[model samples]
Target: MANHKSALKRARQSEEKRMRNRTVKTRIKNVVKEVRSAVAEGAKDTAAQDLNKAKSIIAKAAKKGVIHRKTASRKISRLAKHVNTLTA
Candidate 1:
């Protein structure tokens, strides 16, 4: 338990941030899964579209500090590579 008033306030803020971050992370996972499933089903066009959407969402997440920028770049790169493989 937070003993001081300031500590208690900080704890509350931390809890709120945690919940918000969790939701954003869950959204990221869902979007990534959508792209993966589209790719797995061999829907190249759909995968490409989904990848675009995912890229936007992930970039925004990184901008908001929900994820690291390099991590976002890596994820987008990997997903784009998979989509490109379908065309090759």
Candidate 2:
């Protein structure tokens, strides 16, 4: 328990932030999964489209500090590479 009043307020704020962050992270994962499944199903065009959407969501999440920038970049790069190999 947070003993001080300020500490209690901080704890409350932290919990709210954690819940919000979790939702954003969950959305990011779902989008990424959509892209991955599209790729796995051998639908390059669909995968590409989904990747674009997922990338944007990831970038937004990263910008908001919900996820690391490098992680977002890496995910986009990897998905792009997979789609490339399929089309190539």
| CA RMSD of each candidate after superposition | 0.7, 0.9
Give stretches of model 2 more than 4 Å off: none
Q: Which ten residues in a row have the lowest lDDT in candidate 1?
A: 78-87
Judge candidate 2 at residue 76 and give its lDDT.
84
lDDT by residue for model 1 (4-56), tens: 99999999999999999889889889999999999899998899899999999
Provide the overall lDDT of each model, using Cα atoms, as 2-decimal numbers.
Answer: 0.93, 0.90
lDDT of 2 by residue, 1-88 (tens): 9999999999999999999999999998899889889988999889989988988999999999998999989988987887787788
Query: Residue 30 error for model 2, in Å?
Result: 0.6
